[model samples]
Target chain A: MPKHTIISVSDLNGALKDVVEDTFSDLWVEGEVSNFKAHTSGHLYFSLKDHQSQISCALWQFNRKYLFFTPRDGMKVLAHGALSLYPPRGTYSFVVKSMRPAGEGDLNLAFEALKQKLAAEGLFSTHKKQKLPRYPQRIGVITSETGAAIQDILRVIQYRFPMVHVLLIPVMVQGPGAAEEIARAIYQFNAQSDPIDVLLIGRGGGSIEDLWAFNEEVVARAIYHSTIPIISAVGHETDVTIADFVADVRAATPSNAAELATPDQREVLQIIANLRYTIKNRTLRKLEVEQERLRNLRGSYALNRPRMMLEEQLRRLIEIKRQLLRTTQLQVQQARTSLQLREGQLQQLDPNAPLKRGYVQVFRDQTLLLRANETHPQQLLTLRFLDGSVAVVVNEVSQDR
Target chain B: MSQRLSEHTFSEAIQSLEQIVRTLEQPVPLEEALSLYEEGLSLAHFCEARLQEAQLRIEKLSLQPSEVHPSTL
Candidate 1:
């Protein structure tokens, strides 16, 4: 490389940008705020200074919304962001993604770090969330008995779902041993011979320091490991704590936690009524189906009635009448045919039948003589013809021989 | 019919009643439907009795620091 080589200011700043951002990208800077100004575009421009040194800082609109408090000049704050450089101006600055007041700033950092660590361990996973009971008979509350949280929970539980027992395990909700006490209370409720349906562990609205017990790792771990579902209601709606993430449910207030724990009596009544309506309708439908089946069976079997039996018999009788008519007609036709045949046969047997044909047959008395030997000589005989009768006399009778 | 729910809690009774009603909404054999209706009616009765018998009992559980269970921490 040539020693005299030169580059544009943008190139020099660009080279410095990579070094600054990479070295100090993820770090927190503690200093007094100076020259704090918020742009109309929601970007925040400020300077962080100590007694000896100062640095320009910028908070983007995207990160400004995450700050719980506004930064003002002369406020001691901890600003966390990546160091960035503007190539055009050749100026380096800290882009503050989050800023908090100095005293609780460390706590906030620890809170965020623990939250991420626990999240990585699956403590905040939805799969590990316990199901809340729909109709909770026993609701366990762990808060200071003297606090308004207990009173609020009790009043709400009694007013909404009176058919419930509130087992209040009074525990210190703040200060040094408060987290340990709350954790013990949760475990005590879990180990009881009789189980509570849901546990509400919280205090009334408070400042972050006052609600610090809920952010303690012990409390969050207890909430995570408890077999019973827990509703975290440590502070006001905006003040979210680690217990809120660990618990099965998060309520904005103690009263809200009670509301979540139990069902309203009126709603329960409606559910029961709806179930009754369904059962009634279903049973009625079943009976109607059975009755329809019975009716159908009766219709098919109604031939057992005397009138139906008589109608069936009448139908059979008409069929018999038709058969009789047919049989009688055939018999009459046969009789007529047989009578004509007999008449023809009788005509052929007539003694005078041959007389009309110029052939004579003699009969003595009333006897029918079919042979000449049967006739007597000189005997008077009568011969019958088809139309008339005649008397004849045989002078001689002889055999053909 | 109370003996049928002797072992059930109030919530269990209500849950059973809900289940019975849901089951009855579908097609079931006649005998099974009759039995389910009977069971549901009894469960409903049990739940109603529980509602009437309910008393709001609030008990404060005060434990000393030493009384706290050791394994709980």
Candidate 2:
């Protein structure tokens, strides 16, 4: 094509703006951010630069709301949008729809990569998590010595369980070599002959860069390999680190880690006091039951009416004795009457009664006067009369009718 | 009763005390109940003493000459 003669400057600039906008539109450019400015109208103007090249970029508030993080000068970013040009200024610029920190994006990518690798290795599995000691006698803390994290942890532990022994293994929680230091602290705790019951490793809240040590693969591996139960309290409540996934327990803050380490002594005391009260009450109830049994026995008739029971037995014995005595007296009286009747009958049959009627009994050895025919002369006889005895001679024999 | 209460820790003492309390709740003979009550009282005393006398002791591990890693400082 032949070049046109006498073209206006405005026309040239307008043509260039259309060509630049149509060609470089909807492309991603990578560079370090410079002269970053945010106007009060919620619009951003910045320059994307490299070692040998530079371009201007603008972001509207509508698009800025989609950014995950705020952009700053000297930060490497990947800006996505169209190349825009202004006719009046005769300048070409990139209209940014979105921007990201290249370094942070890489860190985030690495974070995701490591998380997937560890998760596949079963480091974040629930079964791999060691059960935290319900009552930890000794607590091993791995954190910065002079940080507010240590102060917060110590305060919570002292308030909750004063009896716990806190062993602070001061370690660099951030910056270079922090991951190695944290990992070594864990190993050191495990190497001891008498390891602590639980380990609390954490630092206060900060940016992802500041808290990057916790997300390191070395720190995650160390936490996974810990023989003692580990509680990870790495950042604020909203922040989650890789260490949290590998630890046995994940606490939202440093103070929360201390709370999870040991049980509250005050709560324990209250439980013990309740137990004591229950025991005393149970014992008293036992005594009451026993007393009730004793009272029943005491009020029984056998114990209270000993005399009455004996009196009843005594009355029965007396009645039996009286009946025996009456029977014996009747037998004696009947025997006496029979003896007297027999005596009367015997007395009437006596031969002395005939003698009392004046009859006489004669003996015949010397002659008897009862018969005359049987007597011989010159015989003497003796006779028995009622009142006297007489002697007689029989001269004649006579028969009396 | 074989384990001396004084030798037990606060947790152990509390556990034994709770056991005694549970036994007492059952229908036991008077003599046995009396003995259990005595044991519970002793263990309760031990737990209270432990809770009252316990103090917080914080021990800082000495930094090695070559491995002095002060993070925030």
Candidate 3:
């Protein structure tokens, strides 16, 4: 045997992998990206370059999903990954595990990152927006009380529509802690029992950094959750902020926002006038139609021939009377027939019939004496004959014996 | 009934007149049209009285926390 000892194939391969992987594994690299290509095979390939050095990198799809925004060429990024060498290609590369934005300033990058983060959370959905009242009874302005923006808004509102009550919620809109003050003002307005109908939040035209408070995530979220409709008038027409995106409505300027919150008196008057005219003309036409109808009805047969109507009623009355008279005559004839039949029956039963037949009857006073035993001596009595009357005195009375 | 109709407020009378006009404009039978026309005339008289009595007033709104300021124009 020579000085070197013989080794198995598996032991030699394991020893080579340990030397290659352990030396460069778990490395953090910072550089500008270039020649980046996201492969279809769920992996990203890019070259990390510095002024004097360059290294190839591979970020798989699993790691790419964690990135907040799309990675592009020439973007500065910090990547952490494991270093490895492909034996087949005989080239070294970094297999990235995570990455973050690098070149931009920390604040701006943080802002952009947070904005995209919240937007993904649906903090800026249009469906969450509320419509501003068409007619706001009270309008609240949240800005510096002495600012020209407030002046412009007030002037426009007072000039256009004087009916809207203006409420000024004074707050610092710039410098340190301005965002907190603005947010508190918004919440305070919300807590009011009878809050303003709409809130106008804005300032005059300014630089991006000057209006940064409105762009702050806190203020944007405050406006998002506000019960009152907010009209954002942060800057000029071209200037847009997160407040503008989150507000119910966005106006070009403070004056324009005020105009939106309060309707123009002239325009409203014109609308009322138009409505009045429509109502009047329609009503007049309706009245004319009704008058014509009435005139036509007055010319109808029922109204034209009053006497003919009376004659028809009289005819009905005469028919009813004839029916009544016929019924009454039949009832009377029936009654008369019944009376004559009753009279004949009475004549058949009459005791006076015997008197007319020459039968004699005796009576005392107005009483007929039926028995001789009823008479007493010295009793004066009147006798009634059929054709003559006589007076006599009863002596001794006796029976038929 | 006519005096009661005359007592209607401005908006009430206007609204009623609008209703009447709407009813009269419909394609109803002649008998219904005649009755509706009669109603429309009474509404028109009420509306005329309201307009005659209406006076335009422009007043500044009182800025209160709770009070609702009416539309001036």
Instruction: Give each model a TM-score.
Output: 0.62, 0.55, 0.46
Chain A agreement with the truth for model 1, given as TM-score: 0.58
Question: Of the candidates shown, which would achieve the greatest TM-score relative to the real structure?
Answer: 1
The TM-scores, chain A only, for the candidates as listed are 0.58, 0.51, 0.51
Runs in model 3 with CA error above 4 Å?
A: A1-111, A305-401, B1-73
Evaluate all candidate structures by whole-model CA lDDT and list the values in order.
Answer: 0.81, 0.82, 0.71
Query: Could you arrange the candidates by DockQ from highest to lowest?
Result: 1, 2, 3
lDDT of 2: 0.82
For each predicted model, how many residue pairs clash, with residues at least 3 apart or on different chains? 2, 2, 0
Model 2 chain A weakest 10-residue run by lDDT = A366-375
**Pairs with backbone N, CA or C atoms under 3 Å apart (clashes), candidate 2:** A372-A397, A372-A398
Tell me how each candidate scores on DockQ against the true complex. Answer: 0.35, 0.33, 0.03
Per-residue lDDT tens digits of candidate 3, residues A1-401? 56988787666656665787898776768888899998999789999999999998999887665455556788877676788866545567888876655554543564576578768888778899899875565688888776889889888887876656677777778754465567666766776786578999999988666676786656776787789999999889987777888899999999999888876666655544554555556555656777798999888786879777888899999999999999999999999999999998888787566677876666777888788877788998886655677888887877778
Error of 2 at A313 (Å): 5.4
Model 3 chain A: lowest-lDDT 10 consecutive positions: A101-110
- Candidate number that wins on TM-score, 2 or 3: 2
Candidate 1 structure quality by residue, lDDT tens digits, A1-401: 66897888878888898888889887778899999999999999999999999999999998754465667788877677888988888888999976666657756765787688778889899989998988876788999989999889988888878777778888899865677789888878888888788999999888777887787666777898899999999778898999999999999999899999988877887777777778877988997897898788777746458777898899999999999999999999999999999999999997566777876554578787789887777888888656666899888988997
Between prediction 1 and prediction 3, which has the larger lDDT? 1
